[model samples]
Target: MHTSPLITIQAITKSFKGVKAVDNLTLSVGYNEYVALLGPNGAGKTTLVEMIEGLQKPDSGSITIQGKTWQKDAAFLRTIMGISLQETKFTDKMTVSEVLDLFGSFYKLGKKVTRQILQTIRLEEKAKAYVVTLSGGQRQKLALGVAMLNNPQLLLLDEPTTGLDPNARREIWDILMQLKKERGTSMILTTHYMEEAAYLCDRIVIIDKGKILADDTLATLLTSYDPGEVIAFQVSSPLATNSLYEIRGVKDVHWIEEGVKGMLTVESITHTLPVLLNLVESSGNTITSFESRKKTLDDLFRTMTGRSLHE
Candidate 1:
Protein backbone atom coordinates (compact mmCIF):
# COMPACT_ATOMS: atom_id res chain seq x y z
CA MET A 1 0.00 0.00 0.00
CA HIS A 2 1.16 3.54 -0.70
CA THR A 3 2.21 5.63 2.29
CA SER A 4 -0.10 8.43 1.18
CA PRO A 5 -3.74 9.23 0.65
CA LEU A 6 -5.22 6.48 -1.51
CA ILE A 7 -7.76 8.78 -3.18
CA THR A 8 -7.93 12.51 -3.68
CA ILE A 9 -10.95 14.51 -4.94
CA GLN A 10 -10.11 18.13 -5.59
CA ALA A 11 -12.90 20.69 -5.92
CA ILE A 12 -14.95 18.23 -7.95
CA THR A 13 -18.24 19.49 -9.30
CA LYS A 14 -20.69 17.58 -11.45
CA SER A 15 -23.72 19.13 -13.13
CA PHE A 16 -26.96 17.76 -14.47
CA LYS A 17 -28.69 20.16 -16.85
CA GLY A 18 -26.60 22.98 -15.39
CA VAL A 19 -27.49 22.05 -11.82
CA LYS A 20 -24.45 21.12 -9.81
CA ALA A 21 -25.03 17.88 -7.96
CA VAL A 22 -21.62 17.75 -6.33
CA ASP A 23 -20.74 21.32 -5.49
CA ASN A 24 -17.03 21.96 -5.41
CA LEU A 25 -16.55 18.99 -3.14
CA THR A 26 -13.04 18.20 -1.93
CA LEU A 27 -12.25 15.03 0.04
CA SER A 28 -9.41 12.55 0.49
CA VAL A 29 -9.05 9.05 1.87
CA GLY A 30 -5.66 8.05 3.29
CA TYR A 31 -4.06 4.63 2.98
CA ASN A 32 -5.26 2.04 5.50
CA GLU A 33 -7.86 4.44 6.89
CA TYR A 34 -11.65 4.31 7.01
CA VAL A 35 -13.94 7.27 6.48
CA ALA A 36 -17.72 7.76 6.41
CA LEU A 37 -19.52 9.95 3.92
CA LEU A 38 -22.79 10.71 5.68
CA GLY A 39 -25.65 12.82 4.46
CA PRO A 40 -29.39 12.88 4.02
CA ASN A 41 -30.93 12.02 0.65
CA GLY A 42 -29.93 14.36 -2.23
CA ALA A 43 -26.74 15.32 -0.41
CA GLY A 44 -24.65 14.56 -3.53
CA LYS A 45 -22.65 11.78 -1.83
CA THR A 46 -23.75 9.09 -4.29
CA THR A 47 -23.05 11.36 -7.23
CA LEU A 48 -19.61 12.14 -5.85
CA VAL A 49 -18.78 8.46 -5.39
CA GLU A 50 -20.03 7.70 -8.92
CA MET A 51 -17.63 10.29 -10.27
CA ILE A 52 -14.77 8.75 -8.33
CA GLU A 53 -15.74 5.32 -9.67
CA GLY A 54 -15.56 6.70 -13.23
CA LEU A 55 -19.25 6.05 -13.90
CA GLN A 56 -19.49 9.76 -14.53
CA LYS A 57 -17.18 12.68 -15.10
CA PRO A 58 -17.08 15.91 -13.10
CA ASP A 59 -17.72 19.18 -14.91
CA SER A 60 -14.76 20.66 -13.08
CA GLY A 61 -11.83 19.54 -10.86
CA SER A 62 -10.24 16.15 -10.59
CA ILE A 63 -10.18 12.70 -8.95
CA THR A 64 -6.96 10.79 -8.57
CA ILE A 65 -5.91 7.44 -7.17
CA GLN A 66 -2.33 7.44 -5.90
CA GLY A 67 -1.63 10.65 -7.85
CA LYS A 68 -2.89 9.22 -11.17
CA THR A 69 -5.98 10.95 -12.57
CA TRP A 70 -8.97 8.66 -13.02
CA GLN A 71 -9.40 10.19 -16.48
CA LYS A 72 -5.82 9.33 -17.38
CA ASP A 73 -5.80 5.80 -15.93
CA ALA A 74 -9.32 4.41 -15.49
CA ALA A 75 -8.22 0.80 -15.93
CA PHE A 76 -5.41 1.11 -13.37
CA LEU A 77 -7.76 2.78 -10.87
CA ARG A 78 -10.35 0.05 -11.45
CA THR A 79 -7.73 -2.52 -10.48
CA ILE A 80 -7.16 -0.84 -7.12
CA MET A 81 -10.71 0.35 -6.30
CA GLY A 82 -13.51 -1.96 -5.24
CA ILE A 83 -17.08 -0.67 -5.09
CA SER A 84 -20.22 -2.16 -3.55
CA LEU A 85 -23.18 -0.02 -4.41
CA GLN A 86 -26.53 0.49 -2.66
CA GLU A 87 -27.80 -2.37 -4.75
CA THR A 88 -26.09 -5.37 -6.36
CA LYS A 89 -27.38 -7.13 -9.42
CA PHE A 90 -26.37 -10.67 -10.29
CA THR A 91 -27.62 -13.42 -12.60
CA ASP A 92 -30.58 -15.05 -10.86
CA LYS A 93 -29.35 -18.52 -11.82
CA MET A 94 -25.85 -18.13 -10.40
CA THR A 95 -24.96 -19.92 -7.18
CA VAL A 96 -22.93 -18.08 -4.55
CA SER A 97 -19.69 -19.72 -5.59
CA GLU A 98 -20.45 -19.39 -9.30
CA VAL A 99 -21.17 -15.67 -9.00
CA LEU A 100 -17.99 -15.17 -7.05
CA ASP A 101 -16.13 -17.09 -9.74
CA LEU A 102 -17.51 -14.72 -12.38
CA PHE A 103 -16.13 -11.68 -10.56
CA GLY A 104 -12.89 -13.56 -9.90
CA SER A 105 -12.59 -14.19 -13.61
CA PHE A 106 -12.74 -10.46 -14.33
CA TYR A 107 -10.20 -9.66 -11.60
CA LYS A 108 -8.21 -12.86 -12.16
CA LEU A 109 -8.50 -13.89 -8.48
CA GLY A 110 -6.46 -16.94 -7.57
CA LYS A 111 -8.19 -20.06 -6.28
CA LYS A 112 -6.58 -19.64 -2.88
CA VAL A 113 -7.77 -16.02 -2.62
CA THR A 114 -11.34 -16.85 -3.72
CA ARG A 115 -11.51 -19.61 -1.12
CA GLN A 116 -10.30 -17.21 1.55
CA ILE A 117 -12.86 -14.58 0.50
CA LEU A 118 -15.71 -17.08 0.73
CA GLN A 119 -14.60 -18.01 4.23
CA THR A 120 -13.91 -14.40 5.16
CA ILE A 121 -17.48 -13.48 4.22
CA ARG A 122 -18.92 -16.60 5.92
CA LEU A 123 -20.26 -17.79 2.59
CA GLU A 124 -18.42 -21.13 2.64
CA GLU A 125 -21.58 -23.00 3.58
CA LYS A 126 -23.60 -20.93 1.14
CA ALA A 127 -21.27 -21.92 -1.66
CA LYS A 128 -23.93 -24.17 -3.21
CA ALA A 129 -26.70 -21.69 -2.40
CA TYR A 130 -28.10 -19.76 -5.32
CA VAL A 131 -27.85 -15.98 -5.12
CA VAL A 132 -31.62 -15.62 -5.49
CA THR A 133 -32.23 -17.93 -2.50
CA LEU A 134 -30.13 -15.80 -0.14
CA SER A 135 -31.61 -13.41 2.39
CA GLY A 136 -31.03 -9.66 2.06
CA GLY A 137 -28.11 -9.80 4.48
CA GLN A 138 -26.58 -12.81 2.77
CA ARG A 139 -26.82 -11.17 -0.63
CA GLN A 140 -25.22 -8.06 0.84
CA LYS A 141 -22.29 -10.07 2.14
CA LEU A 142 -21.94 -11.71 -1.23
CA ALA A 143 -21.96 -8.33 -2.93
CA LEU A 144 -19.18 -7.20 -0.66
CA GLY A 145 -17.20 -10.36 -1.24
CA VAL A 146 -17.47 -9.93 -5.02
CA ALA A 147 -16.15 -6.39 -4.68
CA MET A 148 -13.16 -7.62 -2.69
CA LEU A 149 -12.45 -10.41 -5.19
CA ASN A 150 -9.66 -8.29 -6.66
CA ASN A 151 -7.96 -7.88 -3.28
CA PRO A 152 -8.55 -4.18 -3.69
CA GLN A 153 -6.48 -1.40 -2.22
CA LEU A 154 -9.60 0.72 -1.54
CA LEU A 155 -13.21 -0.28 -0.82
CA LEU A 156 -16.26 1.90 -1.32
CA LEU A 157 -19.56 0.80 0.19
CA ASP A 158 -22.85 2.63 -0.11
CA GLU A 159 -25.48 1.89 2.54
CA PRO A 160 -24.30 -1.69 2.97
CA THR A 161 -26.68 -2.30 5.89
CA THR A 162 -29.76 -0.47 4.75
CA GLY A 163 -32.08 -3.49 4.85
CA LEU A 164 -30.35 -5.61 7.46
CA ASP A 165 -31.66 -6.72 10.83
CA PRO A 166 -29.73 -5.70 13.94
CA ASN A 167 -27.85 -8.97 14.17
CA ALA A 168 -27.00 -8.95 10.49
CA ARG A 169 -25.85 -5.34 10.74
CA ARG A 170 -23.55 -6.19 13.63
CA GLU A 171 -22.23 -9.16 11.72
CA ILE A 172 -21.36 -6.98 8.74
CA TRP A 173 -19.58 -4.53 11.03
CA ASP A 174 -17.47 -7.37 12.45
CA ILE A 175 -16.54 -8.50 8.93
CA LEU A 176 -15.63 -4.97 7.90
CA MET A 177 -13.46 -4.44 10.93
CA GLN A 178 -11.77 -7.73 10.22
CA LEU A 179 -10.99 -6.63 6.66
CA LYS A 180 -9.65 -3.34 7.99
CA LYS A 181 -7.28 -5.11 10.37
CA GLU A 182 -6.15 -7.91 8.10
CA ARG A 183 -5.97 -6.29 4.68
CA GLY A 184 -5.38 -2.68 5.70
CA THR A 185 -7.81 -1.66 2.93
CA SER A 186 -8.62 2.03 2.77
CA MET A 187 -12.39 2.60 2.71
CA ILE A 188 -14.91 5.29 1.95
CA LEU A 189 -18.49 4.45 2.90
CA THR A 190 -21.79 6.30 2.69
CA THR A 191 -24.60 5.82 5.17
CA HIS A 192 -27.47 7.75 6.68
CA TYR A 193 -27.30 6.17 10.13
CA MET A 194 -25.42 8.38 12.57
CA GLU A 195 -24.88 5.58 15.10
CA GLU A 196 -23.35 3.36 12.43
CA ALA A 197 -21.15 6.21 11.22
CA ALA A 198 -20.00 6.95 14.77
CA TYR A 199 -18.98 3.34 15.38
CA LEU A 200 -17.39 2.49 12.02
CA CYS A 201 -15.87 5.70 10.72
CA ASP A 202 -12.41 7.02 11.66
CA ARG A 203 -13.71 10.41 10.52
CA ILE A 204 -17.28 11.45 9.72
CA VAL A 205 -18.27 13.88 7.00
CA ILE A 206 -21.80 15.23 7.37
CA ILE A 207 -23.39 16.81 4.33
CA ASP A 208 -26.73 18.15 3.17
CA LYS A 209 -28.05 19.54 -0.11
CA GLY A 210 -24.76 19.02 -1.97
CA LYS A 211 -22.73 20.90 0.64
CA ILE A 212 -20.81 19.88 3.71
CA LEU A 213 -22.37 20.79 7.05
CA ALA A 214 -19.73 19.22 9.25
CA ASP A 215 -16.62 17.05 8.82
CA ASP A 216 -14.27 15.80 11.52
CA THR A 217 -13.89 13.23 14.21
CA LEU A 218 -17.31 12.66 15.80
CA ALA A 219 -16.14 13.98 19.16
CA THR A 220 -14.48 17.04 17.63
CA LEU A 221 -17.60 18.04 15.65
CA LEU A 222 -19.86 17.36 18.64
CA THR A 223 -17.83 19.76 20.78
CA SER A 224 -18.61 22.67 18.45
CA TYR A 225 -22.12 22.93 19.91
CA ASP A 226 -23.06 24.56 23.21
CA PRO A 227 -21.93 22.85 26.42
CA GLY A 228 -25.46 23.00 27.81
CA GLU A 229 -26.85 20.30 30.08
CA VAL A 230 -30.25 18.62 29.76
CA ILE A 231 -32.68 17.03 32.19
CA ALA A 232 -35.67 15.10 30.94
CA PHE A 233 -38.54 14.61 33.35
CA GLN A 234 -41.79 12.72 33.07
CA VAL A 235 -44.50 15.27 33.76
CA SER A 236 -47.44 13.95 35.75
CA SER A 237 -49.71 16.60 34.21
CA PRO A 238 -50.60 17.79 30.70
CA LEU A 239 -49.60 21.44 31.14
CA ALA A 240 -45.99 20.78 32.21
CA THR A 241 -44.18 20.81 28.87
CA ASN A 242 -45.10 24.32 27.75
CA SER A 243 -44.72 25.56 31.33
CA LEU A 244 -41.13 24.28 31.39
CA TYR A 245 -40.47 25.92 28.03
CA GLU A 246 -41.27 29.28 29.59
CA ILE A 247 -38.40 28.89 32.05
CA ARG A 248 -35.31 31.15 31.69
CA GLY A 249 -32.34 30.00 29.54
CA VAL A 250 -34.30 27.04 28.19
CA LYS A 251 -33.62 27.28 24.47
CA ASP A 252 -35.77 24.40 23.31
CA VAL A 253 -38.23 22.20 25.16
CA HIS A 254 -39.26 18.94 23.59
CA TRP A 255 -42.15 16.83 24.76
CA ILE A 256 -40.38 13.60 24.03
CA GLU A 257 -43.15 11.66 25.75
CA GLU A 258 -45.87 14.07 24.64
CA GLY A 259 -47.71 16.31 27.16
CA VAL A 260 -47.11 14.03 30.12
CA LYS A 261 -43.29 13.94 29.71
CA GLY A 262 -40.58 16.10 28.14
CA MET A 263 -36.88 16.93 27.84
CA LEU A 264 -35.69 20.47 28.35
CA THR A 265 -32.30 21.62 27.06
CA VAL A 266 -30.97 24.66 28.86
CA GLU A 267 -27.91 26.94 28.94
CA SER A 268 -26.47 26.13 32.41
CA ILE A 269 -27.87 23.38 34.61
CA THR A 270 -27.00 25.18 37.87
CA HIS A 271 -28.87 28.33 36.91
CA THR A 272 -31.66 26.47 35.13
CA LEU A 273 -32.44 24.19 38.05
CA PRO A 274 -34.07 27.04 39.99
CA VAL A 275 -36.16 27.99 36.92
CA LEU A 276 -37.33 24.41 36.49
CA LEU A 277 -38.21 24.13 40.15
CA ASN A 278 -40.20 27.35 39.94
CA LEU A 279 -42.05 26.16 36.83
CA VAL A 280 -42.91 22.87 38.52
CA GLU A 281 -44.22 24.82 41.52
CA SER A 282 -46.42 27.19 39.51
CA SER A 283 -47.71 24.65 36.96
CA GLY A 284 -48.30 21.90 39.52
CA ASN A 285 -46.65 19.47 37.09
CA THR A 286 -45.48 16.41 38.97
CA ILE A 287 -42.16 14.88 38.05
CA THR A 288 -42.05 11.12 38.21
CA SER A 289 -38.43 10.69 37.04
CA PHE A 290 -35.59 12.89 35.82
CA GLU A 291 -32.20 12.61 34.08
CA SER A 292 -29.47 15.20 33.40
CA ARG A 293 -26.83 14.93 30.68
CA LYS A 294 -24.51 17.00 28.54
CA LYS A 295 -25.13 18.11 24.96
CA THR A 296 -25.03 15.45 22.26
CA LEU A 297 -24.69 15.32 18.44
CA ASP A 298 -28.40 14.67 17.99
CA ASP A 299 -29.22 17.80 19.93
CA LEU A 300 -26.55 19.83 18.14
CA PHE A 301 -27.86 18.84 14.72
CA ARG A 302 -31.42 19.60 15.74
CA THR A 303 -30.38 22.99 17.12
CA MET A 304 -28.70 24.03 13.89
CA THR A 305 -31.09 22.53 11.33
CA GLY A 306 -34.42 22.87 13.16
CA ARG A 307 -34.95 19.19 12.41
CA SER A 308 -33.44 15.92 13.55
CA LEU A 309 -31.19 14.00 11.18
CA HIS A 310 -33.90 11.38 10.78
CA GLU A 311 -36.39 14.06 10.00
Candidate 2:
Protein backbone atom coordinates (compact mmCIF):
# COMPACT_ATOMS: atom_id res chain seq x y z
CA MET A 1 0.00 0.00 0.00
CA HIS A 2 1.13 3.54 -0.79
CA THR A 3 0.06 6.99 0.36
CA SER A 4 1.03 10.60 -0.34
CA PRO A 5 2.70 12.86 2.12
CA LEU A 6 -0.03 14.14 4.42
CA ILE A 7 1.65 17.42 5.37
CA THR A 8 4.72 19.37 4.27
CA ILE A 9 6.27 22.25 6.19
CA GLN A 10 9.09 24.12 4.48
CA ALA A 11 11.28 26.60 6.35
CA ILE A 12 8.33 27.73 8.41
CA THR A 13 9.10 30.54 10.80
CA LYS A 14 7.13 32.66 13.25
CA SER A 15 7.92 35.49 15.63
CA PHE A 16 6.31 37.30 18.49
CA LYS A 17 7.24 40.82 19.60
CA GLY A 18 10.39 40.71 17.46
CA VAL A 19 11.53 37.46 19.12
CA LYS A 20 11.81 34.56 16.72
CA ALA A 21 9.69 31.64 17.84
CA VAL A 22 10.06 29.19 14.98
CA ASP A 23 13.29 29.32 12.99
CA ASN A 24 13.57 27.80 9.54
CA LEU A 25 11.68 24.72 10.79
CA THR A 26 11.20 22.10 8.08
CA LEU A 27 9.41 18.77 8.45
CA SER A 28 7.31 16.32 6.43
CA VAL A 29 4.76 13.91 7.91
CA GLY A 30 3.84 10.86 5.87
CA TYR A 31 0.25 9.68 5.85
CA ASN A 32 -0.76 7.13 8.50
CA GLU A 33 2.47 7.81 10.32
CA TYR A 34 2.86 8.83 13.98
CA VAL A 35 5.34 11.64 14.70
CA ALA A 36 6.19 12.93 18.15
CA LEU A 37 7.12 16.63 18.40
CA LEU A 38 9.16 16.98 21.56
CA GLY A 39 10.82 19.93 23.23
CA PRO A 40 10.81 21.93 26.39
CA ASN A 41 8.26 24.67 26.93
CA GLY A 42 8.47 27.72 24.63
CA ALA A 43 9.84 25.46 21.87
CA GLY A 44 7.40 26.96 19.27
CA LYS A 45 5.59 23.65 18.84
CA THR A 46 2.16 25.23 19.25
CA THR A 47 3.02 28.05 16.85
CA LEU A 48 4.28 25.65 14.20
CA VAL A 49 1.28 23.34 14.29
CA GLU A 50 -1.11 26.30 14.29
CA MET A 51 0.35 27.46 11.01
CA ILE A 52 -0.16 24.01 9.52
CA GLU A 53 -3.78 24.10 10.67
CA GLY A 54 -4.16 27.44 8.83
CA LEU A 55 -5.11 29.17 12.07
CA GLN A 56 -1.93 31.21 11.79
CA LYS A 57 0.29 32.08 8.83
CA PRO A 58 4.03 31.63 8.78
CA ASP A 59 6.20 34.72 8.72
CA SER A 60 8.29 33.28 5.87
CA GLY A 61 7.62 29.92 4.22
CA SER A 62 4.97 27.52 3.05
CA ILE A 63 2.73 24.86 4.63
CA THR A 64 0.99 22.57 2.20
CA ILE A 65 -1.50 19.81 2.87
CA GLN A 66 -2.67 17.32 0.29
CA GLY A 67 -5.25 19.90 -0.74
CA LYS A 68 -5.98 23.52 0.15
CA THR A 69 -6.65 23.86 3.89
CA TRP A 70 -7.51 27.53 4.00
CA GLN A 71 -10.62 28.64 5.84
CA LYS A 72 -12.30 28.98 2.46
CA ASP A 73 -11.88 25.25 1.80
CA ALA A 74 -11.71 24.26 5.46
CA ALA A 75 -15.08 22.66 4.97
CA PHE A 76 -13.36 20.12 2.74
CA LEU A 77 -10.26 19.63 4.89
CA ARG A 78 -12.35 19.35 8.05
CA THR A 79 -13.25 15.83 7.07
CA ILE A 80 -9.60 14.79 6.79
CA MET A 81 -8.11 16.49 9.87
CA GLY A 82 -8.95 16.41 13.58
CA ILE A 83 -7.25 18.58 16.20
CA SER A 84 -7.14 18.33 20.00
CA LEU A 85 -5.25 21.00 21.82
CA GLN A 86 -3.92 21.05 25.40
CA GLU A 87 -6.31 23.73 26.41
CA THR A 88 -9.93 22.68 26.52
CA LYS A 89 -12.27 25.56 25.72
CA PHE A 90 -15.50 24.15 27.03
CA THR A 91 -18.22 26.38 28.41
CA ASP A 92 -18.47 25.46 32.10
CA LYS A 93 -22.18 24.84 32.12
CA MET A 94 -22.56 22.86 28.91
CA THR A 95 -23.14 19.14 29.31
CA VAL A 96 -20.69 16.77 27.64
CA SER A 97 -23.26 15.62 25.14
CA GLU A 98 -24.31 19.20 24.46
CA VAL A 99 -20.72 20.26 23.72
CA LEU A 100 -20.07 17.19 21.62
CA ASP A 101 -23.31 17.73 19.72
CA LEU A 102 -22.52 21.41 19.26
CA PHE A 103 -19.07 20.65 17.89
CA GLY A 104 -20.58 17.96 15.66
CA SER A 105 -22.85 20.58 14.12
CA PHE A 106 -19.81 22.49 12.85
CA TYR A 107 -18.74 19.48 10.78
CA LYS A 108 -22.12 18.40 9.35
CA LEU A 109 -21.43 14.83 10.47
CA GLY A 110 -24.28 12.39 10.91
CA LYS A 111 -25.21 10.48 14.04
CA LYS A 112 -23.08 7.51 13.02
CA VAL A 113 -19.82 9.40 13.28
CA THR A 114 -20.81 11.23 16.46
CA ARG A 115 -21.94 8.02 18.13
CA GLN A 116 -18.78 6.20 17.19
CA ILE A 117 -16.63 9.03 18.52
CA LEU A 118 -18.54 9.13 21.79
CA GLN A 119 -17.99 5.42 22.23
CA THR A 120 -14.33 5.56 21.35
CA ILE A 121 -13.76 8.30 23.91
CA ARG A 122 -15.62 6.31 26.60
CA LEU A 123 -17.90 9.23 27.38
CA GLU A 124 -21.18 7.44 26.94
CA GLU A 125 -21.74 7.31 30.69
CA LYS A 126 -20.95 10.98 30.96
CA ALA A 127 -22.63 11.93 27.72
CA LYS A 128 -25.23 13.94 29.59
CA ALA A 129 -22.89 15.01 32.41
CA TYR A 130 -22.02 18.66 32.57
CA VAL A 131 -18.53 19.55 31.41
CA VAL A 132 -17.75 20.88 34.87
CA THR A 133 -18.81 17.62 36.47
CA LEU A 134 -16.53 15.41 34.43
CA SER A 135 -13.05 14.59 35.67
CA GLY A 136 -10.09 16.10 33.85
CA GLY A 137 -9.54 12.78 32.12
CA GLN A 138 -13.14 12.55 30.89
CA ARG A 139 -13.07 16.10 29.65
CA GLN A 140 -9.93 15.38 27.68
CA LYS A 141 -11.64 12.30 26.30
CA LEU A 142 -14.56 14.43 25.21
CA ALA A 143 -12.20 16.87 23.52
CA LEU A 144 -10.75 13.95 21.60
CA GLY A 145 -14.21 12.73 20.77
CA VAL A 146 -15.14 16.14 19.41
CA ALA A 147 -11.95 16.23 17.37
CA MET A 148 -12.78 12.88 15.79
CA LEU A 149 -16.42 13.71 15.02
CA ASN A 150 -15.68 14.18 11.33
CA ASN A 151 -13.84 10.88 11.04
CA PRO A 152 -10.65 12.79 10.27
CA GLN A 153 -7.92 11.08 8.31
CA LEU A 154 -5.17 13.08 10.06
CA LEU A 155 -5.13 14.00 13.75
CA LEU A 156 -3.12 16.73 15.44
CA LEU A 157 -2.72 16.51 19.20
CA ASP A 158 -1.03 19.31 21.11
CA GLU A 159 0.30 18.05 24.45
CA PRO A 160 -2.77 15.90 24.76
CA THR A 161 -1.70 14.61 28.17
CA THR A 162 -0.78 17.90 29.76
CA GLY A 163 -2.00 18.26 33.37
CA LEU A 164 -3.40 14.74 33.28
CA ASP A 165 -2.93 12.38 36.19
CA PRO A 166 -0.71 9.37 35.57
CA ASN A 167 -3.65 7.04 35.10
CA ALA A 168 -5.48 9.45 32.81
CA ARG A 169 -2.37 9.99 30.75
CA ARG A 170 -1.93 6.25 30.34
CA GLU A 171 -5.58 5.92 29.33
CA ILE A 172 -5.17 8.54 26.62
CA TRP A 173 -1.98 6.90 25.41
CA ASP A 174 -3.84 3.61 25.00
CA ILE A 175 -6.63 5.38 23.13
CA LEU A 176 -4.18 6.98 20.70
CA MET A 177 -2.59 3.62 19.97
CA GLN A 178 -6.01 2.12 19.37
CA LEU A 179 -6.98 4.95 17.01
CA LYS A 180 -3.91 4.32 14.89
CA LYS A 181 -4.82 0.67 14.69
CA GLU A 182 -8.56 0.86 13.98
CA ARG A 183 -8.70 3.94 11.76
CA GLY A 184 -5.14 4.06 10.39
CA THR A 185 -5.27 7.77 11.24
CA SER A 186 -2.08 9.73 10.75
CA MET A 187 -1.21 11.62 13.92
CA ILE A 188 1.09 14.51 14.84
CA LEU A 189 1.54 14.35 18.60
CA THR A 190 3.31 17.05 20.60
CA THR A 191 4.36 16.50 24.20
CA HIS A 192 6.79 17.45 26.93
CA TYR A 193 6.83 13.89 28.33
CA MET A 194 9.81 12.09 26.83
CA GLU A 195 8.54 8.72 28.02
CA GLU A 196 5.27 9.28 26.25
CA ALA A 197 7.10 10.43 23.14
CA ALA A 198 9.38 7.39 23.25
CA TYR A 199 6.40 5.13 23.80
CA LEU A 200 4.03 6.52 21.16
CA CYS A 201 6.12 7.85 18.29
CA ASP A 202 7.80 5.68 15.70
CA ARG A 203 9.97 8.67 14.79
CA ILE A 204 10.57 11.91 16.62
CA VAL A 205 11.62 15.50 15.97
CA ILE A 206 13.50 16.96 18.91
CA ILE A 207 13.54 20.74 18.90
CA ASP A 208 15.43 23.03 21.23
CA LYS A 209 14.73 26.76 21.41
CA GLY A 210 13.89 27.22 17.73
CA LYS A 211 16.01 24.63 15.99
CA ILE A 212 15.60 20.98 15.11
CA LEU A 213 18.13 19.35 17.41
CA ALA A 214 17.56 15.75 16.31
CA ASP A 215 15.22 13.82 14.03
CA ASP A 216 15.18 10.04 13.84
CA THR A 217 13.54 6.88 15.11
CA LEU A 218 13.47 6.54 18.89
CA ALA A 219 16.28 3.98 18.89
CA THR A 220 18.47 5.99 16.54
CA LEU A 221 17.92 9.17 18.48
CA LEU A 222 18.88 7.47 21.76
CA THR A 223 21.90 5.76 20.21
CA SER A 224 23.25 8.84 18.45
CA TYR A 225 23.50 10.91 21.63
CA ASP A 226 25.96 10.64 24.51
CA PRO A 227 23.11 10.83 26.97
CA GLY A 228 24.61 7.55 28.19
CA GLU A 229 23.77 5.62 31.35
CA VAL A 230 24.69 5.31 35.01
CA ILE A 231 24.72 2.46 37.51
CA ALA A 232 24.34 3.51 41.12
CA PHE A 233 24.36 1.63 44.43
CA GLN A 234 24.58 2.46 48.10
CA VAL A 235 26.90 0.52 50.41
CA SER A 236 29.43 0.67 53.22
CA SER A 237 32.33 3.04 52.65
CA PRO A 238 34.73 1.75 49.99
CA LEU A 239 37.95 0.07 51.15
CA ALA A 240 39.99 1.17 48.14
CA THR A 241 39.94 4.66 46.61
CA ASN A 242 41.62 3.61 43.38
CA SER A 243 38.87 1.04 42.74
CA LEU A 244 36.97 3.79 40.95
CA TYR A 245 39.15 3.18 37.87
CA GLU A 246 38.73 -0.59 38.22
CA ILE A 247 34.96 -0.86 37.54
CA ARG A 248 34.39 -1.71 33.88
CA GLY A 249 32.76 0.96 31.67
CA VAL A 250 32.98 3.49 34.48
CA LYS A 251 33.33 6.63 32.40
CA ASP A 252 33.69 8.50 35.69
CA VAL A 253 33.28 7.16 39.17
CA HIS A 254 33.50 9.70 41.94
CA TRP A 255 32.24 8.26 45.15
CA ILE A 256 30.34 10.92 47.02
CA GLU A 257 29.15 10.97 50.65
CA GLU A 258 25.37 11.02 50.64
CA GLY A 259 25.53 9.14 53.93
CA VAL A 260 26.04 5.78 52.11
CA LYS A 261 25.65 6.71 48.43
CA GLY A 262 27.95 4.81 46.09
CA MET A 263 27.80 5.38 42.31
CA LEU A 264 29.47 4.31 39.07
CA THR A 265 28.50 5.93 35.77
CA VAL A 266 29.03 4.03 32.53
CA GLU A 267 29.49 6.30 29.53
CA SER A 268 27.46 3.99 27.32
CA ILE A 269 24.62 1.58 28.03
CA THR A 270 26.66 -0.97 26.07
CA HIS A 271 28.71 -1.29 29.27
CA THR A 272 27.78 -4.21 31.48
CA LEU A 273 26.31 -3.56 34.93
CA PRO A 274 27.26 -7.04 36.22
CA VAL A 275 30.91 -6.02 36.21
CA LEU A 276 30.18 -2.85 38.18
CA LEU A 277 27.98 -4.80 40.60
CA ASN A 278 30.60 -7.49 41.01
CA LEU A 279 33.23 -4.86 41.82
CA VAL A 280 30.99 -3.28 44.44
CA GLU A 281 30.31 -6.71 46.04
CA SER A 282 33.92 -7.92 46.02
CA SER A 283 35.22 -4.62 47.39
CA GLY A 284 33.68 -5.50 50.82
CA ASN A 285 31.13 -2.71 50.24
CA THR A 286 27.60 -3.60 51.36
CA ILE A 287 25.55 -4.31 48.25
CA THR A 288 22.40 -2.68 49.52
CA SER A 289 20.74 -2.31 46.11
CA PHE A 290 21.39 -1.16 42.55
CA GLU A 291 19.62 0.06 39.41
CA SER A 292 20.64 0.85 35.84
CA ARG A 293 19.95 4.39 34.68
CA LYS A 294 19.58 4.59 30.94
CA LYS A 295 19.52 7.89 29.14
CA THR A 296 15.85 8.76 28.79
CA LEU A 297 14.33 11.33 26.47
CA ASP A 298 14.38 13.68 29.44
CA ASP A 299 18.11 13.09 29.83
CA LEU A 300 18.60 13.85 26.15
CA PHE A 301 16.33 16.90 26.20
CA ARG A 302 17.94 18.25 29.36
CA THR A 303 21.43 17.65 27.95
CA MET A 304 20.61 19.69 24.85
CA THR A 305 18.62 22.45 26.54
CA GLY A 306 20.37 22.62 29.92
CA ARG A 307 16.92 22.72 31.47
CA SER A 308 14.06 20.42 32.31
CA LEU A 309 11.00 20.10 30.10
CA HIS A 310 8.91 22.20 32.48
CA GLU A 311 11.55 24.88 32.38
- Cα lDDT of all candidates, in order? 0.81, 0.77
- What TM-score, computed on C-alpha atoms, does each candidate reach? 0.87, 0.82
Q: Write the per-residue lDDT of candidate 2 for residues 155-237, one digit (tens) a residue.
A: 89898888789988888888888878888888888898888888888889988767788888888877777546866666766
Q: Cα miss at 286, model 1 (Å)?
A: 4.4
Query: Candidate 1 lDDT, tens digit per residue, 39-121?
Result: 76777888988888888888889888888887688789899888998878888798998888878988877667778889988
lDDT of 2 at 227: 45
Candidate 2 deviant stretches above 4 angstroms: 1-3, 67-73, 232-265, 268-291
lDDT of 1 at 57: 88
Give the local distance difference test score of model 2: 0.77
Backbone clashes in model 2:
0
In the order shown, what is each candidate's alpha-carbon RMSD? 3.0, 3.9
The candidate scoring highest on lDDT is: 1
Q: How accurate is candidate 1 locally (lDDT)?
A: 0.81
